[model samples]
Target: MSIDTLARTSRAKRKISARRWLVPYVFLSPAGLLFVVFLAIPIIYAIYLSFRGMHVSGGGPFGVREETWVGFDNYIRTFTDAEFFAGFGRLAIYGVIAVPVTLGLALLFALLLDLPRVRAARFSRIAIFVPYAVPGVIASLLWGFLYLPSTSPLNWILNQLGFADLEVLTGGALFPAVANIAIWSGVGFNMIIIYTSLRGIPNELHEAARIDGASEWQIAWRIKIPLVAPALVLTGLFSLIGTLQLYGEPTTLRPMTNEISQTWVPLMKITRDAFARDDLSLAAASSVVLAIGTLVVSVVLLRMTQKKAFGDGS
Candidate 1:
Protein backbone atom coordinates (compact mmCIF):
# COMPACT_ATOMS: atom_id res chain seq x y z
CA MET A 1 0.00 0.00 0.00
CA SER A 2 1.05 3.61 -0.57
CA ILE A 3 2.42 5.57 2.49
CA ASP A 4 -0.44 8.09 2.31
CA THR A 5 -3.11 5.30 2.29
CA LEU A 6 -1.35 3.42 5.10
CA ALA A 7 -1.20 6.61 7.24
CA ARG A 8 -4.93 7.29 6.62
CA THR A 9 -5.90 3.69 7.61
CA SER A 10 -3.70 3.92 10.74
CA ARG A 11 -5.38 7.18 11.80
CA ALA A 12 -8.84 5.65 11.14
CA LYS A 13 -8.01 2.60 13.34
CA ARG A 14 -6.75 4.85 16.19
CA LYS A 15 -9.96 6.94 16.11
CA ILE A 16 -12.12 3.77 16.22
CA SER A 17 -10.12 2.34 19.15
CA ALA A 18 -10.38 5.63 21.11
CA ARG A 19 -14.13 5.89 20.50
CA ARG A 20 -14.69 2.24 21.51
CA TRP A 21 -12.96 2.76 24.88
CA LEU A 22 -14.20 6.30 25.60
CA VAL A 23 -17.90 5.73 24.78
CA PRO A 24 -18.46 3.01 27.35
CA TYR A 25 -16.57 4.90 30.04
CA VAL A 26 -18.56 8.08 29.31
CA PHE A 27 -21.84 6.19 29.56
CA LEU A 28 -20.87 4.25 32.69
CA SER A 29 -19.11 6.97 34.71
CA PRO A 30 -22.18 8.38 36.51
CA ALA A 31 -23.52 5.03 37.73
CA GLY A 32 -20.03 3.74 38.56
CA LEU A 33 -19.27 6.86 40.65
CA LEU A 34 -22.64 6.64 42.42
CA PHE A 35 -22.24 2.93 43.23
CA VAL A 36 -18.74 3.54 44.63
CA VAL A 37 -19.62 6.62 46.65
CA PHE A 38 -23.03 5.65 48.03
CA LEU A 39 -23.07 1.85 48.16
CA ALA A 40 -19.48 0.58 48.21
CA ILE A 41 -18.09 3.11 50.70
CA PRO A 42 -20.90 2.69 53.27
CA ILE A 43 -20.84 -1.12 52.98
CA ILE A 44 -17.04 -1.22 53.47
CA TYR A 45 -17.27 1.12 56.44
CA ALA A 46 -20.05 -0.97 58.03
CA ILE A 47 -18.06 -4.18 57.51
CA TYR A 48 -15.04 -2.54 59.16
CA LEU A 49 -17.17 -1.28 62.02
CA SER A 50 -18.75 -4.71 62.49
CA PHE A 51 -15.40 -6.35 63.24
CA ARG A 52 -14.39 -3.90 65.96
CA GLY A 53 -15.74 -3.38 69.46
CA MET A 54 -15.61 -0.02 71.22
CA HIS A 55 -13.79 0.10 74.54
CA VAL A 56 -14.45 2.86 77.07
CA SER A 57 -11.80 3.06 79.79
CA GLY A 58 -12.62 4.80 83.09
CA GLY A 59 -15.66 7.11 83.39
CA GLY A 60 -16.86 10.64 82.56
CA PRO A 61 -15.88 12.83 79.54
CA PHE A 62 -12.17 12.17 80.12
CA GLY A 63 -12.58 8.44 79.41
CA VAL A 64 -10.49 7.09 76.54
CA ARG A 65 -12.38 5.20 73.86
CA GLU A 66 -10.77 2.71 71.49
CA GLU A 67 -11.92 0.39 68.71
CA THR A 68 -10.50 -3.06 69.25
CA TRP A 69 -10.79 -5.89 66.74
CA VAL A 70 -13.07 -8.61 68.10
CA GLY A 71 -13.24 -10.95 65.09
CA PHE A 72 -16.76 -12.51 64.72
CA ASP A 73 -17.99 -11.58 68.19
CA ASN A 74 -20.54 -9.06 66.87
CA TYR A 75 -21.97 -11.55 64.37
CA ILE A 76 -22.04 -14.29 67.01
CA ARG A 77 -23.85 -12.02 69.42
CA THR A 78 -26.34 -10.96 66.76
CA PHE A 79 -27.18 -14.56 65.82
CA THR A 80 -27.56 -15.60 69.47
CA ASP A 81 -29.74 -12.65 70.49
CA ALA A 82 -33.42 -13.54 70.92
CA GLU A 83 -34.53 -10.04 69.96
CA PHE A 84 -32.79 -10.22 66.57
CA PHE A 85 -34.28 -13.63 65.80
CA ALA A 86 -37.75 -12.48 66.90
CA GLY A 87 -37.46 -9.43 64.68
CA PHE A 88 -36.58 -11.68 61.72
CA GLY A 89 -39.59 -13.90 62.46
CA ARG A 90 -41.92 -10.93 62.61
CA LEU A 91 -40.57 -9.53 59.32
CA ALA A 92 -40.99 -12.91 57.64
CA ILE A 93 -44.64 -13.04 58.69
CA TYR A 94 -45.10 -9.47 57.52
CA GLY A 95 -43.52 -10.30 54.17
CA VAL A 96 -45.75 -13.34 53.77
CA ILE A 97 -48.84 -11.14 54.06
CA ALA A 98 -47.61 -8.00 52.29
CA VAL A 99 -45.62 -9.10 49.21
CA PRO A 100 -48.12 -11.54 47.70
CA VAL A 101 -51.15 -9.36 48.41
CA THR A 102 -49.50 -6.27 46.98
CA LEU A 103 -48.20 -8.00 43.84
CA GLY A 104 -51.49 -9.85 43.28
CA LEU A 105 -53.49 -6.66 43.52
CA ALA A 106 -51.04 -4.89 41.26
CA LEU A 107 -51.32 -7.61 38.59
CA LEU A 108 -55.11 -7.54 38.83
CA PHE A 109 -55.19 -3.79 38.44
CA ALA A 110 -52.76 -3.84 35.55
CA LEU A 111 -54.82 -6.44 33.71
CA LEU A 112 -58.05 -4.54 34.37
CA LEU A 113 -56.47 -1.31 33.13
CA ASP A 114 -55.35 -3.09 29.96
CA LEU A 115 -58.92 -4.15 29.17
CA PRO A 116 -60.72 -2.26 26.41
CA ARG A 117 -64.14 -2.01 28.09
CA VAL A 118 -62.83 -0.35 31.26
CA ARG A 119 -64.18 3.20 31.42
CA ALA A 120 -62.15 6.17 32.65
CA ALA A 121 -59.05 4.00 32.54
CA ARG A 122 -56.71 6.95 32.21
CA PHE A 123 -58.11 8.72 35.26
CA SER A 124 -58.21 5.55 37.31
CA ARG A 125 -54.65 4.59 36.40
CA ILE A 126 -53.32 8.02 37.41
CA ALA A 127 -55.37 8.10 40.63
CA ILE A 128 -54.16 4.66 41.69
CA PHE A 129 -50.53 5.58 40.97
CA VAL A 130 -50.77 8.81 43.01
CA PRO A 131 -49.95 7.05 46.29
CA TYR A 132 -46.48 6.15 44.96
CA ALA A 133 -45.58 9.84 45.03
CA VAL A 134 -46.29 10.05 48.80
CA PRO A 135 -43.31 9.44 51.05
CA GLY A 136 -43.42 6.28 53.16
CA VAL A 137 -43.07 8.23 56.46
CA ILE A 138 -45.91 10.59 55.57
CA ALA A 139 -48.12 7.73 54.37
CA SER A 140 -47.57 5.87 57.64
CA LEU A 141 -48.38 8.95 59.70
CA LEU A 142 -51.63 9.56 57.82
CA TRP A 143 -52.70 5.92 58.10
CA GLY A 144 -51.69 5.84 61.77
CA PHE A 145 -54.28 8.46 62.69
CA LEU A 146 -56.89 6.75 60.50
CA TYR A 147 -56.25 3.45 62.32
CA LEU A 148 -57.05 4.96 65.73
CA PRO A 149 -60.33 3.92 67.38
CA SER A 150 -61.25 7.45 68.42
CA THR A 151 -60.51 9.08 65.07
CA SER A 152 -61.04 6.39 62.42
CA PRO A 153 -64.17 6.26 60.29
CA LEU A 154 -64.21 2.46 60.60
CA ASN A 155 -64.41 2.83 64.37
CA TRP A 156 -67.38 5.20 63.98
CA ILE A 157 -69.12 2.71 61.72
CA LEU A 158 -68.45 -0.10 64.19
CA ASN A 159 -69.82 2.04 67.06
CA GLN A 160 -73.05 2.65 65.08
CA LEU A 161 -73.31 -1.10 64.55
CA GLY A 162 -73.48 -1.60 68.39
CA PHE A 163 -69.75 -2.15 69.04
CA ALA A 164 -68.48 0.84 71.03
CA ASP A 165 -64.81 -0.11 70.70
CA LEU A 166 -62.83 -1.19 67.65
CA GLU A 167 -59.11 -0.83 67.41
CA VAL A 168 -57.38 -1.69 64.14
CA LEU A 169 -53.91 -1.06 65.58
CA THR A 170 -54.20 -3.72 68.27
CA GLY A 171 -52.86 -7.30 68.26
CA GLY A 172 -54.01 -9.67 65.47
CA ALA A 173 -55.22 -6.66 63.45
CA LEU A 174 -51.76 -5.05 63.55
CA PHE A 175 -50.24 -7.26 60.87
CA PRO A 176 -52.98 -6.51 58.35
CA ALA A 177 -52.95 -2.84 59.35
CA VAL A 178 -49.25 -2.51 58.57
CA ALA A 179 -49.54 -4.58 55.41
CA ASN A 180 -52.40 -2.40 54.19
CA ILE A 181 -50.27 0.75 54.28
CA ALA A 182 -47.44 -0.93 52.39
CA ILE A 183 -49.85 -2.39 49.82
CA TRP A 184 -51.60 0.92 49.29
CA SER A 185 -48.36 2.80 48.81
CA GLY A 186 -46.64 0.19 46.66
CA VAL A 187 -49.48 -1.29 44.57
CA GLY A 188 -49.72 1.73 42.30
CA PHE A 189 -46.07 1.64 41.25
CA ASN A 190 -46.13 -2.10 40.65
CA MET A 191 -49.38 -1.77 38.70
CA ILE A 192 -47.87 0.86 36.45
CA ILE A 193 -44.82 -1.29 35.76
CA ILE A 194 -46.91 -4.36 34.95
CA TYR A 195 -49.31 -2.30 32.86
CA THR A 196 -46.46 -0.76 30.88
CA SER A 197 -45.14 -4.21 30.13
CA LEU A 198 -48.62 -5.44 29.24
CA ARG A 199 -49.04 -2.55 26.80
CA GLY A 200 -45.87 -3.60 24.98
CA ILE A 201 -47.44 -6.97 24.16
CA PRO A 202 -48.84 -7.24 20.63
CA ASN A 203 -52.59 -6.94 20.17
CA GLU A 204 -52.42 -9.66 17.47
CA LEU A 205 -51.90 -12.33 20.09
CA HIS A 206 -55.07 -11.37 21.92
CA GLU A 207 -56.96 -11.08 18.63
CA ALA A 208 -55.79 -14.51 17.51
CA ALA A 209 -56.79 -16.00 20.87
CA ARG A 210 -60.19 -14.39 20.59
CA ILE A 211 -60.61 -15.78 17.07
CA ASP A 212 -59.76 -19.22 18.48
CA GLY A 213 -62.80 -18.93 20.83
CA ALA A 214 -60.83 -18.19 23.97
CA SER A 215 -62.71 -16.30 26.69
CA GLU A 216 -61.33 -13.11 28.24
CA TRP A 217 -60.55 -14.98 31.44
CA GLN A 218 -58.81 -17.76 29.55
CA ILE A 219 -56.81 -15.32 27.46
CA ALA A 220 -55.79 -13.36 30.56
CA TRP A 221 -54.79 -16.45 32.46
CA ARG A 222 -53.14 -18.32 29.58
CA ILE A 223 -51.72 -15.47 27.55
CA LYS A 224 -51.37 -12.17 29.39
CA ILE A 225 -50.31 -13.57 32.76
CA PRO A 226 -47.65 -15.79 31.20
CA LEU A 227 -46.41 -12.93 29.06
CA VAL A 228 -46.06 -10.56 32.01
CA ALA A 229 -44.44 -13.07 34.36
CA PRO A 230 -41.14 -11.22 34.19
CA ALA A 231 -42.74 -7.96 35.33
CA LEU A 232 -44.53 -9.80 38.14
CA VAL A 233 -41.22 -11.27 39.21
CA LEU A 234 -39.66 -7.82 39.23
CA THR A 235 -42.51 -6.40 41.33
CA GLY A 236 -42.42 -9.38 43.69
CA LEU A 237 -38.67 -8.98 44.27
CA PHE A 238 -39.05 -5.26 45.00
CA SER A 239 -41.93 -5.92 47.40
CA LEU A 240 -40.01 -8.72 49.11
CA ILE A 241 -36.97 -6.47 49.63
CA GLY A 242 -39.16 -3.63 50.93
CA THR A 243 -40.96 -5.98 53.32
CA LEU A 244 -37.67 -7.31 54.67
CA GLN A 245 -36.51 -3.74 55.31
CA LEU A 246 -39.83 -2.57 56.79
CA TYR A 247 -39.37 0.17 59.38
CA GLY A 248 -41.37 3.35 58.76
CA GLU A 249 -44.95 2.20 59.34
CA PRO A 250 -44.35 0.24 62.53
CA THR A 251 -41.90 2.82 63.89
CA THR A 252 -44.32 5.69 63.22
CA LEU A 253 -47.19 3.85 64.88
CA ARG A 254 -45.13 2.95 67.95
CA PRO A 255 -45.93 6.13 69.87
CA MET A 256 -49.68 5.68 69.37
CA THR A 257 -49.80 2.01 70.34
CA ASN A 258 -48.04 -0.34 72.76
CA GLU A 259 -48.05 -3.19 70.23
CA ILE A 260 -44.84 -2.22 68.50
CA SER A 261 -41.74 -2.86 70.61
CA GLN A 262 -38.36 -1.16 70.22
CA THR A 263 -37.14 -4.02 68.05
CA TRP A 264 -40.32 -4.50 66.05
CA VAL A 265 -38.38 -5.01 62.81
CA PRO A 266 -34.78 -5.87 61.93
CA LEU A 267 -34.03 -2.36 60.71
CA MET A 268 -35.65 -0.92 63.81
CA LYS A 269 -33.48 -3.22 65.92
CA ILE A 270 -30.37 -2.03 64.08
CA THR A 271 -31.34 1.61 64.62
CA ARG A 272 -31.99 0.97 68.31
CA ASP A 273 -28.66 -0.79 68.72
CA ALA A 274 -26.75 1.90 66.85
CA PHE A 275 -28.34 4.98 68.44
CA ALA A 276 -30.57 4.11 71.39
CA ARG A 277 -28.19 1.68 73.05
CA ASP A 278 -24.94 3.04 71.53
CA ASP A 279 -23.79 -0.46 70.50
CA LEU A 280 -22.34 0.24 67.10
CA SER A 281 -20.76 -3.16 66.70
CA LEU A 282 -24.01 -4.99 67.31
CA ALA A 283 -25.83 -2.59 65.01
CA ALA A 284 -23.23 -3.03 62.29
CA ALA A 285 -23.47 -6.80 62.60
CA SER A 286 -27.27 -6.67 62.44
CA SER A 287 -27.06 -4.38 59.41
CA VAL A 288 -24.73 -6.80 57.66
CA VAL A 289 -27.03 -9.70 58.47
CA LEU A 290 -29.99 -7.78 57.11
CA ALA A 291 -28.12 -7.01 53.87
CA ILE A 292 -27.06 -10.62 53.45
CA GLY A 293 -30.56 -11.89 54.22
CA THR A 294 -32.06 -9.55 51.64
CA LEU A 295 -29.50 -10.57 49.05
CA VAL A 296 -30.10 -14.28 49.65
CA VAL A 297 -33.89 -13.99 49.54
CA SER A 298 -33.78 -11.92 46.34
CA VAL A 299 -31.41 -14.33 44.62
CA VAL A 300 -33.36 -17.41 45.70
CA LEU A 301 -36.70 -15.98 44.65
CA LEU A 302 -35.34 -14.79 41.29
CA ARG A 303 -33.80 -18.17 40.60
CA MET A 304 -36.95 -20.08 41.55
CA THR A 305 -39.20 -17.81 39.51
CA GLN A 306 -36.86 -17.87 36.55
CA LYS A 307 -36.80 -21.64 36.60
CA LYS A 308 -40.57 -21.87 36.77
CA ALA A 309 -41.18 -19.20 34.15
CA PHE A 310 -38.41 -19.82 31.67
CA GLY A 311 -37.56 -23.44 32.61
CA ASP A 312 -33.83 -22.65 32.59
CA GLY A 313 -31.36 -21.79 35.29
CA SER A 314 -30.78 -18.05 35.57
Candidate 2:
Protein backbone atom coordinates (compact mmCIF):
# COMPACT_ATOMS: atom_id res chain seq x y z
CA MET A 1 0.00 0.00 0.00
CA SER A 2 1.08 3.61 -0.59
CA ILE A 3 2.35 5.57 2.48
CA ASP A 4 -0.50 8.15 2.12
CA THR A 5 -3.18 5.42 2.04
CA LEU A 6 -1.63 3.61 5.03
CA ALA A 7 -1.57 6.85 7.06
CA ARG A 8 -5.27 7.55 6.22
CA THR A 9 -6.29 4.02 7.33
CA SER A 10 -4.37 4.43 10.58
CA ARG A 11 -6.13 7.76 11.27
CA ALA A 12 -9.55 6.16 10.62
CA LYS A 13 -8.82 3.29 13.04
CA ARG A 14 -7.68 5.74 15.77
CA LYS A 15 -10.84 7.84 15.25
CA ILE A 16 -13.05 4.74 15.60
CA SER A 17 -11.23 3.63 18.73
CA ALA A 18 -11.62 7.11 20.24
CA ARG A 19 -15.38 7.12 19.54
CA ARG A 20 -15.80 3.62 21.05
CA TRP A 21 -14.08 4.77 24.26
CA LEU A 22 -16.04 8.08 24.42
CA VAL A 23 -19.61 6.90 23.58
CA PRO A 24 -20.48 4.95 26.75
CA TYR A 25 -19.16 7.65 29.09
CA VAL A 26 -20.97 10.37 27.10
CA PHE A 27 -24.24 8.54 27.56
CA LEU A 28 -23.52 7.80 31.25
CA SER A 29 -22.45 11.38 32.15
CA PRO A 30 -25.88 12.67 33.20
CA ALA A 31 -26.65 9.67 35.43
CA GLY A 32 -23.15 9.70 36.93
CA LEU A 33 -23.44 13.44 37.66
CA LEU A 34 -26.81 12.92 39.36
CA PHE A 35 -25.52 10.07 41.49
CA VAL A 36 -22.60 12.19 42.70
CA VAL A 37 -24.72 15.29 43.29
CA PHE A 38 -27.53 13.52 45.11
CA LEU A 39 -26.29 10.34 46.79
CA ALA A 40 -22.50 10.38 46.90
CA ILE A 41 -22.06 13.99 48.04
CA PRO A 42 -24.66 13.68 50.80
CA ILE A 43 -23.14 10.46 52.18
CA ILE A 44 -19.62 11.92 52.20
CA TYR A 45 -20.86 15.11 53.86
CA ALA A 46 -22.70 13.12 56.52
CA ILE A 47 -19.58 11.12 57.35
CA TYR A 48 -17.58 14.34 57.59
CA LEU A 49 -20.16 15.95 59.84
CA SER A 50 -20.22 12.89 62.08
CA PHE A 51 -16.65 13.52 63.20
CA ARG A 52 -17.32 17.17 64.14
CA GLY A 53 -19.08 18.52 67.21
CA MET A 54 -21.13 21.70 67.14
CA HIS A 55 -20.71 24.75 69.38
CA VAL A 56 -22.94 27.85 69.43
CA SER A 57 -22.14 31.26 70.88
CA GLY A 58 -24.23 32.76 73.70
CA GLY A 59 -24.40 36.09 71.73
CA GLY A 60 -28.04 36.07 70.50
CA PRO A 61 -29.15 35.85 66.77
CA PHE A 62 -25.83 36.71 65.12
CA GLY A 63 -23.97 34.25 67.35
CA VAL A 64 -21.15 32.20 65.87
CA ARG A 65 -21.91 28.50 65.43
CA GLU A 66 -18.65 26.61 65.21
CA GLU A 67 -18.21 23.01 64.14
CA THR A 68 -15.15 21.60 65.88
CA TRP A 69 -13.40 18.37 64.87
CA VAL A 70 -13.84 15.85 67.73
CA GLY A 71 -12.39 12.76 66.17
CA PHE A 72 -14.42 9.68 67.30
CA ASP A 73 -16.12 11.28 70.31
CA ASN A 74 -19.47 11.61 68.57
CA TYR A 75 -19.36 7.95 67.60
CA ILE A 76 -18.38 7.00 71.15
CA ARG A 77 -21.31 8.95 72.62
CA THR A 78 -23.73 7.43 70.12
CA PHE A 79 -22.51 3.93 71.00
CA THR A 80 -22.82 4.64 74.72
CA ASP A 81 -26.29 6.22 74.45
CA ALA A 82 -28.88 4.23 76.39
CA GLU A 83 -31.71 5.41 74.14
CA PHE A 84 -29.80 4.25 71.06
CA PHE A 85 -29.32 0.68 72.36
CA ALA A 86 -32.93 0.56 73.59
CA GLY A 87 -34.13 1.61 70.14
CA PHE A 88 -32.12 -1.23 68.55
CA GLY A 89 -33.53 -3.76 71.02
CA ARG A 90 -37.07 -2.72 70.13
CA LEU A 91 -36.21 -2.85 66.43
CA ALA A 92 -34.78 -6.39 66.76
CA ILE A 93 -38.08 -7.58 68.26
CA TYR A 94 -39.97 -5.67 65.58
CA GLY A 95 -37.92 -7.40 62.85
CA VAL A 96 -38.63 -10.79 64.37
CA ILE A 97 -42.36 -10.08 64.30
CA ALA A 98 -42.69 -8.21 60.98
CA VAL A 99 -40.33 -9.94 58.52
CA PRO A 100 -41.68 -13.49 58.80
CA VAL A 101 -45.34 -12.45 58.83
CA THR A 102 -44.98 -10.11 55.85
CA LEU A 103 -42.95 -12.59 53.76
CA GLY A 104 -45.24 -15.50 54.70
CA LEU A 105 -48.40 -13.65 53.64
CA ALA A 106 -46.74 -12.37 50.45
CA LEU A 107 -45.59 -15.89 49.53
CA LEU A 108 -49.01 -17.35 50.33
CA PHE A 109 -50.80 -14.75 48.20
CA ALA A 110 -48.31 -15.20 45.37
CA LEU A 111 -48.87 -18.98 45.37
CA LEU A 112 -52.64 -18.54 45.50
CA LEU A 113 -52.55 -16.15 42.55
CA ASP A 114 -50.28 -18.55 40.66
CA LEU A 115 -52.89 -21.32 40.93
CA PRO A 116 -54.83 -22.30 37.81
CA ARG A 117 -58.40 -20.99 37.44
CA VAL A 118 -58.10 -18.75 40.50
CA ARG A 119 -61.13 -16.43 40.60
CA ALA A 120 -60.56 -12.71 39.97
CA ALA A 121 -56.80 -13.12 39.95
CA ARG A 122 -56.27 -9.73 38.35
CA PHE A 123 -58.62 -8.07 40.81
CA SER A 124 -56.94 -9.75 43.75
CA ARG A 125 -53.52 -8.57 42.55
CA ILE A 126 -54.73 -4.98 42.26
CA ALA A 127 -56.53 -5.07 45.61
CA ILE A 128 -53.52 -6.50 47.43
CA PHE A 129 -51.21 -3.85 45.94
CA VAL A 130 -53.56 -0.94 46.67
CA PRO A 131 -52.23 -0.30 50.18
CA TYR A 132 -48.68 -0.09 48.79
CA ALA A 133 -49.78 3.00 46.86
CA VAL A 134 -50.77 4.72 50.12
CA PRO A 135 -48.19 6.94 51.80
CA GLY A 136 -46.52 5.66 55.02
CA VAL A 137 -47.70 8.65 57.13
CA ILE A 138 -51.28 8.18 55.94
CA ALA A 139 -51.20 4.42 56.60
CA SER A 140 -49.86 5.10 60.11
CA LEU A 141 -52.69 7.55 60.80
CA LEU A 142 -55.37 5.17 59.49
CA TRP A 143 -54.14 2.22 61.53
CA GLY A 144 -53.58 4.44 64.58
CA PHE A 145 -57.28 5.33 64.57
CA LEU A 146 -58.19 1.65 64.25
CA TYR A 147 -55.99 0.85 67.26
CA LEU A 148 -57.68 3.39 69.52
CA PRO A 149 -60.07 1.63 71.88
CA SER A 150 -62.70 4.40 71.81
CA THR A 151 -62.74 4.96 68.04
CA SER A 152 -62.21 1.34 66.97
CA PRO A 153 -65.13 -0.50 65.33
CA LEU A 154 -63.50 -3.75 66.46
CA ASN A 155 -63.77 -2.56 70.03
CA TRP A 156 -67.43 -1.65 69.45
CA ILE A 157 -68.13 -5.14 68.09
CA LEU A 158 -66.34 -6.75 71.04
CA ASN A 159 -68.29 -4.62 73.49
CA GLN A 160 -71.58 -5.62 71.87
CA LEU A 161 -70.55 -9.28 72.17
CA GLY A 162 -69.86 -8.82 75.95
CA PHE A 163 -66.09 -8.96 75.36
CA ALA A 164 -63.74 -6.46 76.96
CA ASP A 165 -61.97 -3.80 74.92
CA LEU A 166 -58.72 -4.89 73.26
CA GLU A 167 -55.86 -2.53 74.05
CA VAL A 168 -53.78 -2.98 70.94
CA LEU A 169 -51.65 0.15 71.39
CA THR A 170 -49.87 -0.87 74.57
CA GLY A 171 -47.59 -3.54 76.10
CA GLY A 172 -46.85 -6.67 74.04
CA ALA A 173 -49.54 -5.81 71.48
CA LEU A 174 -47.75 -2.56 70.50
CA PHE A 175 -45.07 -4.29 68.41
CA PRO A 176 -47.58 -6.17 66.26
CA ALA A 177 -49.87 -3.15 66.04
CA VAL A 178 -47.12 -1.10 64.38
CA ALA A 179 -45.95 -4.16 62.45
CA ASN A 180 -49.46 -4.73 61.11
CA ILE A 181 -49.37 -1.36 59.37
CA ALA A 182 -45.95 -2.18 57.88
CA ILE A 183 -47.21 -5.64 56.84
CA TRP A 184 -50.44 -4.27 55.41
CA SER A 185 -48.53 -1.78 53.26
CA GLY A 186 -45.64 -4.11 52.35
CA VAL A 187 -47.21 -7.59 51.86
CA GLY A 188 -49.03 -6.71 48.64
CA PHE A 189 -45.94 -5.17 47.07
CA ASN A 190 -43.81 -8.21 47.96
CA MET A 191 -46.60 -10.47 46.65
CA ILE A 192 -46.52 -8.65 43.31
CA ILE A 193 -42.75 -9.14 43.18
CA ILE A 194 -43.01 -12.88 44.01
CA TYR A 195 -46.07 -13.33 41.80
CA THR A 196 -44.23 -11.79 38.84
CA SER A 197 -41.30 -14.15 39.45
CA LEU A 198 -43.68 -17.11 39.70
CA ARG A 199 -45.29 -16.13 36.35
CA GLY A 200 -41.82 -16.14 34.77
CA ILE A 201 -41.36 -19.86 35.55
CA PRO A 202 -41.89 -22.01 32.42
CA ASN A 203 -45.21 -23.82 31.98
CA GLU A 204 -43.27 -26.93 30.85
CA LEU A 205 -41.85 -27.35 34.38
CA HIS A 206 -45.36 -27.52 35.89
CA GLU A 207 -46.64 -29.78 33.11
CA ALA A 208 -43.77 -32.23 33.60
CA ALA A 209 -44.35 -32.29 37.35
CA ARG A 210 -48.06 -32.94 36.86
CA ILE A 211 -47.38 -35.78 34.45
CA ASP A 212 -45.20 -37.39 37.09
CA GLY A 213 -48.27 -37.57 39.40
CA ALA A 214 -47.21 -34.59 41.57
CA SER A 215 -50.23 -33.03 43.28
CA GLU A 216 -50.83 -29.24 43.18
CA TRP A 217 -49.39 -28.89 46.70
CA GLN A 218 -46.40 -31.03 45.75
CA ILE A 219 -45.78 -28.98 42.64
CA ALA A 220 -45.94 -25.71 44.53
CA TRP A 221 -43.81 -26.96 47.43
CA ARG A 222 -41.20 -28.82 45.37
CA ILE A 223 -41.17 -26.69 42.23
CA LYS A 224 -42.77 -23.24 42.50
CA ILE A 225 -41.57 -22.25 45.99
CA PRO A 226 -38.00 -23.34 45.27
CA LEU A 227 -37.88 -21.29 42.08
CA VAL A 228 -39.37 -18.25 43.83
CA ALA A 229 -36.97 -18.40 46.81
CA PRO A 230 -34.91 -15.46 45.50
CA ALA A 231 -37.94 -13.19 45.63
CA LEU A 232 -38.60 -14.29 49.22
CA VAL A 233 -35.00 -13.47 50.21
CA LEU A 234 -35.19 -10.02 48.58
CA THR A 235 -38.50 -9.21 50.27
CA GLY A 236 -37.15 -10.44 53.60
CA LEU A 237 -34.14 -8.12 53.27
CA PHE A 238 -36.40 -5.14 52.57
CA SER A 239 -38.64 -6.04 55.52
CA LEU A 240 -35.62 -6.29 57.81
CA ILE A 241 -34.43 -2.86 56.72
CA GLY A 242 -37.88 -1.37 57.22
CA THR A 243 -38.25 -2.94 60.65
CA LEU A 244 -34.86 -1.60 61.81
CA GLN A 245 -35.82 1.88 60.67
CA LEU A 246 -39.25 1.75 62.28
CA TYR A 247 -40.36 5.27 63.16
CA GLY A 248 -43.47 6.61 61.43
CA GLU A 249 -46.20 4.48 62.99
CA PRO A 250 -44.85 4.81 66.50
CA THR A 251 -44.34 8.57 66.12
CA THR A 252 -47.84 8.99 64.65
CA LEU A 253 -49.39 6.97 67.48
CA ARG A 254 -47.39 8.78 70.19
CA PRO A 255 -50.05 11.40 70.75
CA MET A 256 -52.55 8.75 71.78
CA THR A 257 -50.32 6.82 74.18
CA ASN A 258 -47.72 7.45 76.87
CA GLU A 259 -45.75 4.29 76.13
CA ILE A 260 -43.73 5.74 73.28
CA SER A 261 -40.88 7.99 74.40
CA GLN A 262 -39.15 10.77 72.45
CA THR A 263 -36.53 8.18 71.53
CA TRP A 264 -38.97 5.50 70.45
CA VAL A 265 -36.76 4.27 67.60
CA PRO A 266 -33.21 4.89 66.41
CA LEU A 267 -34.27 7.01 63.44
CA MET A 268 -36.67 8.96 65.66
CA LYS A 269 -33.85 9.65 68.11
CA ILE A 270 -31.61 10.80 65.29
CA THR A 271 -34.32 13.11 63.97
CA ARG A 272 -34.91 14.56 67.43
CA ASP A 273 -31.19 15.10 67.98
CA ALA A 274 -30.77 16.81 64.62
CA PHE A 275 -33.80 19.11 64.60
CA ALA A 276 -35.05 19.43 68.14
CA ARG A 277 -31.71 19.65 69.94
CA ASP A 278 -29.89 21.22 66.99
CA ASP A 279 -27.13 18.62 67.32
CA LEU A 280 -26.41 17.63 63.75
CA SER A 281 -23.08 16.03 64.69
CA LEU A 282 -24.69 13.55 67.05
CA ALA A 283 -27.39 12.82 64.52
CA ALA A 284 -24.81 12.25 61.81
CA ALA A 285 -22.88 9.82 64.03
CA SER A 286 -26.07 7.88 64.89
CA SER A 287 -27.05 7.78 61.21
CA VAL A 288 -23.63 6.39 60.23
CA VAL A 289 -23.91 3.73 62.92
CA LEU A 290 -27.39 2.78 61.76
CA ALA A 291 -26.27 2.63 58.13
CA ILE A 292 -23.27 0.45 58.97
CA GLY A 293 -25.33 -1.88 61.17
CA THR A 294 -27.92 -2.27 58.42
CA LEU A 295 -25.22 -3.03 55.85
CA VAL A 296 -23.64 -5.73 58.04
CA VAL A 297 -26.99 -7.39 58.78
CA SER A 298 -28.08 -7.37 55.12
CA VAL A 299 -24.71 -8.78 53.96
CA VAL A 300 -24.90 -11.57 56.54
CA LEU A 301 -28.45 -12.43 55.48
CA LEU A 302 -27.66 -12.42 51.75
CA ARG A 303 -24.68 -14.71 52.39
CA MET A 304 -26.88 -17.07 54.42
CA THR A 305 -29.57 -17.26 51.73
CA GLN A 306 -27.22 -17.18 48.71
CA LYS A 307 -26.91 -20.91 48.27
CA LYS A 308 -30.67 -21.57 48.30
CA ALA A 309 -31.58 -18.59 46.12
CA PHE A 310 -28.84 -18.72 43.49
CA GLY A 311 -27.86 -22.47 43.56
CA ASP A 312 -24.23 -21.50 44.25
CA GLY A 313 -22.36 -19.56 46.91
CA SER A 314 -19.85 -16.86 46.12
**Using Cα atoms with residue i matched to residue i, what is each candidate's TM-score against the true structure?**
0.94, 0.92
lDDT of 1: 0.92
Model 1 spans with C-alpha error above 4 angstroms: 1-5, 58-63, 160-162
Write down the TM-score for model 1: 0.94
Which candidate tops TM-score? 1
Please, what are the lDDT tens digits per residue for candidate 1 over residues 25-144? Answer: 999999999999999999999999999998888899899988899999999999999998899899888888998899989999999999878999999999999999999999999998
Q: RMSD to the native, candidate 2?
A: 2.5
In each prediction, how many residue pairs overlap at the backbone (N, C-alpha, C within less than 3 A)?
A: 0, 0
Candidate 2 lDDT, 33-146, residue by residue in tens: 999999999999999999999777678898888878999999999989999999998888888888999999999999999999899999999999999999999999999889
Q: Which residue pairs show backbone clashes in model 2?
A: none
Candidate 1: lDDT of 33? 100
Among these predictions, the greatest lDDT belongs to: 2
